[model samples]
Target chain A: MLVQFYNVSKVYPKGKALDDISLKIDRGEFVFLMGPSGAGKSTIIKMMFREEEPTRGQIFIAERSLVRMKRSDVPRVRRGMGIVFQDFKLLERKTVYENVAFAMEVVSAPHREIKARVPEVLRMVGLEDKENSFPGELSGGEQQRVGIARALANQPLLLIADEPTGNLDIDTSLEILDLLIDINRKGTTIIMATHDRELVKAARKRVILLDKGKVAADYAPGEYLVC
Target chain B: MLKNIWYFCREAVKSMARNHLLSLATISTVAICILILGMAVLATLNASHLITRLESDLEIMSYLDKDLTADQASEVKQALEAIPGVESVRFVSREEALQYLQDSFGEDRYNLEETMGKNPLPDGYEIKALDPHQVPVIAQQVEQVAGIERVNYGKEMVNNLFLATKWVRVLSMAFIVLLSLGAIFLIATTIRLAIFSRRKEIYLMKLIGSTDWFVRWPFFIEGILLGTAGSLIAILLLAVGYETLIGSIQSVPFVPVLSNRALLIEVYAGLVMVGALLGVLGTYISLNRFLDV
Candidate 1:
């Protein structure tokens, strides 16, 4: 298993976000987590990156339990994973190239590697010509594409995206989804959280329907039972 | 590692450029604080030097017995010189003593010579002690020497100089420490504002798996640069101001300040060290509060 949530539960002062949730994702699998706003999809994504720890039980990535890991070791674990946010958190001050290059720079990647790989990743995202354009000048779709390219810069094995297409129109949403699916097909395990039922039904991959804080249903391709 | 430090330095320069006004404010505040502190220190140093000169100038004048011959007076001078704390002993004859009186009397030299037919001034030995504090003990020993009448040194003058310089030193030291702390607080506030403006960058760095140290290095470098720059400015101002002060007060012989070459190097070096120390300390405080990963 590349990722595991073993009876993990998160309880805040207000209420429980995830109540005894247990799931496993295999290597190179594309999984969709579907639910309403309060269904703990984001919490699961946060736990995978060790951003929020489980209030009870444990989580592991590549068989290493993150609960017992030292705080200093969190960065190393996170480096092996890429994350994308719902609102397309691209730095407004940075150009598309700088936005993507920032991830590599933070890890102290060599200048030559950064100079070479940034353009390649921009090309992969089909924004090669827009490398110098700042995020403020780009459309919503283009900004999200820059966000994806930045996430992919480090070549992480696991890509956890929270509502990746939440802010786009139907056409743009499909385009972004197709890009994610293509990236997933190229041997990256992708777990995306979304509330768009139509997109979920169309993708038809391994769908884990989260209701209230627990996994309400789990189905494979061609076996999804939409609510 | 060298490349990483170079990156950090570059980032620090970039950050300072981004927040130019705040950086300037911090540097100016630090410079002003150090300037006041340096001035206080210099004042204390000059006061202390003057007091030391006054103390060293203290000497005991030992008058000889009236019936003592010239040979006996020379023997007394040699005996006083042999004492442990005695620096030197010079025997002044009656004629030389009269000439000293005449020189001090200036225009009244003839009137004094006519009024006093005989030279009543006694032959005495002027005794200088190695340690000014040991003057009383040396004076007592000189008075007990054979053919010596009495030993005289200005006790009250030495006591007043010690008391006055002691207070000056204590007050100036307290003022310097307080001002330094105030300067550090202002420095930290300036860095804190810089940090506040770029908090999003910090958050992004942490989210993207940058180590705590990687995110902190730039800010650390910024703090150091601010501190060192402020100290350099303060030192320059102090050097110019002190030279001017010494120039204008050249006629005041009693001041007895240290020469420019000596005091300048010492004060400049001390200010630089203090500025750097405060910079590091201010950075530590700010980072400790905001840079938690």
Candidate 2:
């Protein structure tokens, strides 16, 4: 398994965000975590990526103990995974090329490697022509494309998307899903958090359902039925 | 790192250009502070020059006692000239003194000598010394000269000059410190406000994973620009002030020392350094408050 969560629970003093949940996923698996808002879907994905640690229980990534990871190793852990955010958090000041290139820059990729890899990732997201465009100049869908390109820039082993297609239209959303599918088929483990029902249902992927911070059902080829 | 600094400096210049009003106000503040400080320095410098001139002019004029014989007075004059502090002694002969008195007063003072039934004027040695500090000590020792009756130095005038110059020195040092601090505060606050305004950019940069130093470089460079610009402004102001003063002083040939170019250059360079210090200090203040957090 590339990621494992053992009795993972997160408490925020007011209430729990994720209840005692245990799940495991191996390499190259495509899983959809479906839940309505505040169902702890994002928390699970976040914990897997170490964006936010579980308040309790052990979370593991690539057989490494995330709970015991040193502070300096956080970036190293993150470098091994790709994250696509819902808000399309592209650096507004930076161009599309620089936005995608930033991931490579932080990992200290050599210049020649960045030059070759950036355009390739952009091409994967179908944003190869908009390299010089800024985020504000791009439409929401196009901006999200740039965000996805940035996430793929590191050619990570694991892909985590938190509501990745929230702002896209139906057709645009499917295109983004297809991009994620393409990436997963290339041997990257993918965990996508979403509230979209039709897409998850039609895709027939393995689905984990959460309700009130606890995993309500784990279904193969699941739909958003637990809601 | 040099590349990073270039980017930083470029950003700094860009910010300075964009925040034109703020930059102008800060630069003017620094210029005014340095200008006042530079003037005080120039004053003390000129005062020191004047003191040196006065010290060089000091010569002890010894009056020979009327009862002394001509040859005895001559011998005492030679001995007085040979004293350690004594550089050279100009003997004011009685006849020469009489001629000098008549020439200065425009009257027949030579007739008063006949009326008094004795030559009132006595031959005296005008004793010179290497330093003004040695004057009192040398004067006291020379009082014992065989034909000398009095060794006077017009204590009232010399004491006033010393007191005045001592006050000028105290004022100069105090003024310099206060004005430099003013410049620092102005430039620092300016940089802080500049950074505060661009805090959104800062947060965006941080969120995008720029290290604290990389995030701070622009503001730091802005500070360097402020310092460099403030100093240049201050230097310019000082030059204008110096020229205006020199123009007035030029017609009056009595003020020869203020015409020095080397001292003026030194003062301008010093103001430039003060500006640089203000720039660095201000940037540090802003960065320490904003970036480290």
Candidate 3:
């Protein structure tokens, strides 16, 4: 398994965010976490990135339990994964090229590698002409595309995107989905969380529906019930 | 490591430039506080020097009655020499006293002789005391001698000088500590504002797997630069002001001041180090609070 949550649970002071959740994702799989706003899909994604720890149970990424890892080791684990959010958190003052290059720089990537890889990622995201443009100058969808490019800058084996299309129009959403699909076809495992039933239907991927902090249902590709 | 340092320096310089007004405010506040602290240090050092000189020179002067015969004056001197803590007593004749005054007046002796034909200076015994703390007691004993006119021991003046020196020491220490705290708080707030302005960048950096130190290096450099800059300005100002004061003080002839080159260098180095230290402290405080991720 590439990622595993063995009976993981997370409880905030307010309530239980994820209760008794167990699941497994294999390598190169494209999985959808379909749920409403309070279904704890984001929490599950956060646990995978080690942003939040399971209150009770073990979470393993590539067979190493995240709960037992030291704080200093969290970054090493995150380097093998890429994360995207609904807000498309880009540094507004930085150019698109800088936004992607910054991700590599944080990991102390070699100057030659950064210089060579940033342009390639920009081209992959179809933002080659806009590399020099600041995020404020781009459309919402283009900004999210830059977000994806930045996430992929490290060329991780796994990608976790939380509502990647939540802030986009339907046409832009499909484009972003197509881009994700293409990246998945190139062999990166993807776990995307969203509430859009129609989008999930259109993608025809394996779906995990969460309700009230539990996995309500699981469906194979092209067989999900619209919830 | 060298590349990271270059990047940190570049980023620090850019951030400082971006918030030029706040940076200027922080720097000026630090400079002014350090300048006051330097002045206090100089004052405390000079005052202690003056006190040491005064304490070492403690003496009791007992004037002799003009009508006393030579034998009576000799008897009075012998009695004074017998007093506890009296090291020695030297008798000055009327003529010798006048001559001593003339010597002390230097080039103005001729003018003093022209102004007054008769010798008006008093003949007295200069008594050196073994202990400065006992000068007042020995003076009281000498005043009781039969042929002595009056006693002058500078007791009140010495007591006041000691009191003033004590206060100066206390006040200078308090000022240094208070000013350092104020500088730290101001620098910390300014750095905090800078971090807040770039919070998005920091958050993104954290998400991309940068270690806490990697994210903090640029801000730490920014703080160090501000601290050093502020202290350097204060040191330059103090040097100019102190050198001018020294020039003017030379005309006053006898006011003790700290003019040793080594001591001045020590003060300068101390101020610069303090500035840099406070900068690091302030940066540490702000970063710890905002960079928990």
By lDDT, the best candidate is 3
Which scores better on DockQ, 1 or 2?
1
Give the alpha-carbon lDDT of every model: 0.86, 0.78, 0.88
The sequence of per-residue lDDT tens digits that candidate 1 reaches over residues A37-132 is 999999899889887888999898988899978989988898888888889888777889999999999999999999999998898889999989
Under CAPRI classification, how is model 1 graded? medium
Q: Which candidate do you rate higher for TM-score, 1 or 3?
A: 1
Candidate 1 wrong stretches, greater than 4 Å: A7-21, A53-56, A208-224, B60-86, B92-153
Which consecutive 10 residues in model 3 chain A have the weakest lDDT in total?
A218-227
lDDT digits (tens) for residues A90-194 of candidate 2: 767779999888777655567789999999999888888999989999988899889888878888888888898998888989888888888888888889999
Recovery fraction of native interface contacts for candidate 3: 0.59
Model 1 steric clash total:
0
Could you give the candidate ranking by DockQ, starting with the highest?
3, 1, 2
Q: Quick one: how many clashes does candidate 2 have?
A: 0
Model 3, A83-126: lDDT tens per residue?
88899999877899998998998888989999999999888889
Arranged by TM-score, best first: 1, 3, 2
DockQ of each: 0.54, 0.14, 0.56
Best by DockQ: 3
- lDDT by residue for model 2 over B194-218, one digit each (tens)? 7787775564344333556766667
Looking only at chain B, model 1 earns a TM-score of 0.89
In TM-score terms, which candidate is top? 1
Model 3 residue A28 CA deviation in Å: 1.6
